[model samples]
Target: MIRLVAGYATAALTMLVLDGVWLTVATPRLYKPRIGELLADKPSLPPAVVFYFLYVAAIVVLAIQPALREGGWRRLLTHAVVFGLVAYATYDLTNQATLKTWSTTITLVDMAWGTLVTTAAASAGYAVMRWIGK
Candidate 1:
């Protein structure tokens, strides 16, 4: 149970740091001009907070914990990537399908970024659990 909690913490922190950086730097650069003034300089805190909590929980529950239980780097990495792709694709593809202003470029980029970051976060969590167990 402690190991599971630690894994969750590790995944949450990893996602927060990496996703925060991407949103701060890459998102603005890639999206601002296309999105124009619609992109707020500061995101609203309530939704952001909710999203972070749910997102991290999903990662831990669906990917990190499962990978750890499966007990292999291959399983860890594969599940993380698949989870990321599915989650991001749901968001990006839905936006592309529904939003008038959404761009395919942004959709593709975000999906790729999601896969990369989630895998990294999950892998980091797995590593942390291993270290802790040792």
Candidate 2:
């Protein structure tokens, strides 16, 4: 129980920090220039909060826990990357299909960001679990 809680916290924190930085840098340079009209002056907090909570939970459950049980870094990374790719692709491709303003550059960049961030968070979760000895 303790390990699970700790791992989740670590992963969530890692993700939040990484994503915060990415958004701060990318929003102006990438998203705003391309999709400024689509963006709100200020983001809606409720959806962002919910996304973070659910995303972190999924990473911990699907990637971190399995890798810990199987005792392999390779397993953890593979699961993390696959989860990231699939999850991001679902969102990006859907937007590209439905939204006229969506761009291929955004899809590619966001997907890569998602995969990298997910793997980093999952790795952090795995490290915390191992450090605590479980």
Candidate 3:
């Protein structure tokens, strides 16, 4: 239980910090919509574009830890589920982020992006562990 909780907490907090730096210093472009009206005001904004940026960042982080993804598919999948929980926890922190949102397609894409990322991270981490025989 402790490991599970810790894993999720770490992942969620990491994303929040990443989001902060991303919104504040690295890429102000990501946060432009944070202030706009949920739906009526940001039709020009593309959800895929937004999620793409986030997933790219997360993937970069995972890439830096190549050992994480060296494991077999079964082990990778298990860790991915935990990562999914973390991702969902992070997303849930602001359900309002989806309020007055755009079409279901956009939301589905975003969700898929999150799921893929979480799985990738788990696979990456598992690989790393297997490489190190940890």
Please name the candidate that would achieve the greatest lDDT relative to the true structure.
2
lDDT of 3: 0.46
Tell me the RMSD of model 2 versus the true structure: 0.8
lDDT of each: 0.84, 0.94, 0.46
lDDT of 2 by residue, 2-61 (tens): 998999999999999999999999999999998889999998999999999999999998
Tell me the tens digit of each residue's lDDT in model 1 across 42-68: 779999889878887787888766766
Which candidate has the highest TM-score of all?
2
Tens-digit lDDT track for model 3 on 15-127?
44544454355223322344234434333458745664565445334432332445456644654555555565566445536555433443444455556556655454444
Query: On a 0 to 100 scale, what is the lDDT of residue 64 in model 1?
Result: 68
Arrange candidates by TM-score, highest first: which order?
2, 1, 3
Task: Provide TM-scores for the models.
Answer: 0.91, 0.97, 0.39
| Candidate with the larger lDDT of 2 and 3 | 2
Clashes per candidate (backbone, < 3 Å):
0, 0, 13
Candidate 2 overall lDDT versus native:
0.94
lDDT of model 3 at position 48: 44
